[model samples]
Target: MNTRQIIIIALLIIALVIPGSSLLGEKEYPKFLEEPWDHSPITVYIDEQNTPPHYSPSYQPTVIRALQYWEKGGNGKLSYNPVFELANTSDADIYIMWVENMEEVTGAEEGVAGFCRPMIANGRYVHADIVLEVGDYKGYSWQQYGDDNMEQLVTHELGHALGLGHSNDIRDIMYPTYEQRENLNPLLVQTTYPLIVISILIAIGISGYLGVGWLRYHKRRKRLENELLKEMK
Candidate 1:
């Protein structure tokens, strides 16, 4: 064959051989994935002693709402309680100590909104710094703004405190950007239908391969037996 034709024939042979060689190879992808969390129940205690007076009205309720939403949707378990004395002892899995002043906590700066910092040594508790603007009220700010501004913002920050990363989905509550109450999106449930279908297809393919292999084995054995019998005759 000419040079061009010979190169074309070699390319076709390589393409066919590569796929068959891959089928004989033992590489496999993992079928199951582990859930992110350790599945342990987390109890959170809000430090009432150091919490600012301005945040008293919206503080506890906003935290409770956020916790409820997380517990209901996520696989991990969480519980919360307001505490007066946790100064000397660490009891809960997560201690949410609210500081009256932002300057008291290291590595915490006043963000455009609220600020949160996790205790690295303990890694279980997170301290939140609440600084109210000149005109912001404790209880009335959430009520006046509704979901338009503060409630979702606090909820989003609290989610970070609870070990949740931002979701890329705009429709999920964990989205990086915050929306107003009327515009807020609820968390969506993850579905297993796609995974189930893919698993079934894999099973079908494996079964078909085994069946074809068994049939070919029997045909080869029968041909070898007839040849031996003819030689004996």
Candidate 2:
């Protein structure tokens, strides 16, 4: 309404602008293939490799959890039937495997997590396999995330296998670059949490500084008015 109020509002808005503004430009919303999965609740099988330097007891469970997270996290956009836990058969719409070797694979770069290769037929994705990096790679460690990047790896590849392309959005699960996301919500892990806190702190600091100035101005104005009144008397 007034100049001081407008300044405060502008400062607060600027403080909060970083989170949403970063998502603007180029507009690659829902980057996807020509065809989506032809069926509901796509089935997935994990080819668990239980060998030294490649296997952990947590691997299988973590894979299953990633599958389940897909079913729940996407707000009904995805459904997964994890068949690997029940049987050894890798017969499913999607197959997930762990590997330490990357020399032969296409996109398994050093420090890379994994990659997805989908088989398409009749303009539809028929089958796909996700190869995940196991153990440490290029001296980099997986000390973060409860599942240790496994969940994000599977989830990202699953998005591709389901006919979705990599998202430009940093907070998206299908973001091309692999960022350390300890939380299921990528926003919190990627950009939202610390930035949001910083913005709030900035807004508070600005308000406090302005408030102090306004209080000083008010005191000075009141004292000057009393002096004027005394002079008039």
Which candidate should be chosen as best, given lDDT against the real structure?
2
Q: What is the alpha-carbon RMSD of candidate 2 to the true structure? A: 17.0
Question: Which pairs of residues have clashing backbones in candidate 1?
Answer: 147-181, 148-181
User: Candidate 2, which segments miss by more than 4 Å at Cα?
Assistant: 1-27, 49-52, 75-88, 103-107, 138-146, 179-233
**Every model's Cα RMSD, please?**
20.0, 17.0
Candidate 1's error at 28, in angstroms? 23
List TM-scores for all candidates, in order.
Answer: 0.38, 0.53
Off by over 4 Å in 1: 1-39, 74-91, 99-110, 119-150, 178-233
lDDT of 2 by residue, 5-95 (tens): 8797776767666654444222234423433467756677777653335456687787777666665654233333322233356777788
Q: Write the per-residue lDDT of candidate 1 for residues 126-178, one digit (tens) a residue.
A: 23332322112344342223433555655665555554445555665556563
Q: lDDT of each model, Cα atoms only?
A: 0.41, 0.56
Question: What shift in Å separates residue 101 of candidate 2 from its native position after superposition?
Answer: 4.0
Candidate 2's displacement at residue 221, Å, is 68
